[model samples]
Target: MFTRIQAQVLGALGVVVVLGALTLFLVPASEPAPAPVAQPAPEVVDVPEEVPFVTHQVVGTSREGRTIEVYTYGTGTRDILLVGGIHGGYEWNSVLLAYEMMDYFEAHPTAIPADVTVHIVPVLNPDGLAQVVSGEGRFTPDAVRTDVPLGTGRFNAAGVDLNRNFGCKWQPESSWRGTRVSAGTAAFSEPEAAALREYVLAHMPESVVFWHSKAGAVFASECHEGVLPETKTLMQTYADAAGYKPILTFDAYPVTGDAEGWLASIGIPAITVEFHTHESMDWAENLAGVTALLARP
Candidate 1:
């Protein structure tokens, strides 16, 4: 039924189709698709700083069972220990000053000299810190007592002025508004004082800084024995930075059993940094002083 032209066209189309199918199915497998490239593994991101090597936390449980922690920093051959708020409620600003130092060390890990280790005990009296924080996170030595239903919170839960309670030179229990208060039972009877001693013994730091309030001077680490020659150098370092005159002797009172004196007795160059009437004015100067101390050549 078909003409010669039609038959030839149909035969040619069939051959073309068969050839195309054979070429695709039998193409000798050109190199398999290049193996999918592997992207480099993603890089690790930001990491929080690690807690510095802690010599130890000399633990002193407060009358309220709260922890009074002493953190030892750095491990240089030349070491320094900074203690804050041994006076408890009487000197709340002292504790805050210590905390500021702690924050600085945490944020600026490299601020401390590589050759020296700094020990920071932020709060000497957790009991006092608790009362201070409950009201204002910051406090001062001259903070006037406003009418409060609970009365003055100037002592521990056990009603002992821990500073006065140390046995450096024990005195008869005096009254601060009818609160009998020179000192309690015996030397180092107060847990906070005891904890400080424990830390000082354990670290045996080359120098020490004990923060106090209202005194507004850097007392050379001194005692009945004498002012340390190294303490004179250390005081000058901090005093030069603060721009305030350093009072070498704190002959303000018949003070005894104070932590600084205790430290000095053992020949550790200890300084007590007393702020102006207000605690807030103390920190920036102290920061400058501390940096200068750390940066000393």
Candidate 2:
């Protein structure tokens, strides 16, 4: 019986030793070394480099050093100045409208009348435009809207009513029935106004078309002196094509130091086209009006 017990104990010890060896060898010493994965080469994305264009940017830096871009097209003696976005961010439709025109000319390239040069100051107030661009990307004609920043942005970056900052029958103070107005420190005090004035003086464009919104009719500029003869003809020409009646005078309110009036004083014909529709871009209609306006008499 004693011999049998010793023999059983020896057998158990041998089984335990074999099991311990199996566990040590079969189990992972550390984590099983992961199989090396051959990673595919990373894809190289193609990004186009900056390509310069013929369109020159004449910097009209605002008081805040915001750059206002002016683009000129065509190589002609007869120049047509197109000014838009005068109301800044609130009336982004005007800015879009102007940009649309620029796009048109860019695509067509030959749309610009050879004898007539076209100049576009697409965004007159960079600060205002920056506000609009940061919002939704679209501004429709049906939405005769503006994102007024604290209602203080109705004017330029410097709070000068650009239209009211011109030298045309300028006033010390102008009234805006909408509860916001600015006339600047003096006539053309704001850099925006000065830049435009300088460009106008330098270019001496034969006519200027200023775009606005919600009025839906075209108006010719007139001060105390009265409308110029060419102003009436210019308005008629555009209206005849656009199928809208000509509003010889704005008469909505008395405006002083108006840009149109200033242009008129310098013997340049200027017409203000105020779109009637909002929330919808009437660019098609207005383009016709402009095309007709640009058509040779």
Candidate 3:
């Protein structure tokens, strides 16, 4: 019943609708968007455990309030005390040698025997050491002053010869190479000396080795009791191992109130292991000597 134009229009609309359906049928649908991917968590790392056997302590302080530290390695009952820098920067090599020993032990913890405990005091007179060296605790050879006088930085801040402040054959004044030096007001009057004395009394090490310089020898210690028989064995043991000359006494000059002598007076065996020079540590020789001593009966 519709007119020809109206029928044509309807036919065109229907054709347009048919074309749209054919296009939809020909096109394929896209895949759904991929689900979000989760990133892996960061890896966890474990911290290194501390070495329980190696330990350090601040036993006392120097005259200028500098800490006097002791580094202990091993956990045995028989203790061996190694001291250096008692003459401070005047014999700075001793301090260097002590630190070298500490470094060695730290690297080779098992180098210490099962029966022995090693205690090291790298700088007993930090003030005197500071007088010459620029840094605290550990220092290098470059830190030392080349123009330092022979006797510079030899005494503590109190101007007392710490070596002469001990009780054995103590006098108000002591001689060092014919030059008189103060022995402190009395036995262990200086705080540094007193601290060492207290440590010795408290721990009572089986033996002690005090490092010095320019003597090129191992001298045994003595007081009123002369030298302990074990001291002779120790001297020979260290001297033979290190190829250093062993002497029964330091007779070149008179030394009073000496720390080694004080040890002898109290029945402790002690020796002075003097390095060949003030600059070199002689590491191999001393290490062999220490090893031999540790292995001895």
Can you write out model 3's per-residue Cα lDDT over 1-297, one digit (the tens) per residue?
A: 999999999999999999999977776667554679988897797876754678998888888999888899987778999999999999999999999999999999889998888999998899999989987768999999878788789999999999999999999998999688999999999888888998889899989999999889999999998899989999999999998999998889899999999999999999999999988999998999999988886
Top lDDT model:
3
Candidate 1, after superposition: displacement of residue 215 in Å?
Answer: 2.5
Residues 224-247, candidate 2: write the lDDT tens digits. 568899889989888777766788
Off by over 4 Å in 2: 1-54, 135-152, 178-180
lDDT of 1 by residue, 9-45 (tens): 9999999999999977886787565798999999998
**lDDT score at residue 177, model 1, on the 0-100 scale:** 42
- Which parts of model 1 are misplaced by more than 4 Å? 1-58, 135-151, 172-180
The weakest ten consecutive residues by lDDT in model 3 span 25-34
Report the number of the highest-TM-score candidate: 3
Model 2 CA lDDT for position 190: 87
Q: TM-score for each prediction? A: 0.70, 0.74, 0.82
| Steric clash count of candidate 1 | 2
Give Cα-based local distance difference scores for all models. Answer: 0.71, 0.76, 0.91
Report the C-alpha displacement of residue 63, candidate 3, in angstroms: 1.0
Model 1 root mean square deviation, Cα atoms: 14.3
TM-score-better candidate, 2 vs 3: 3
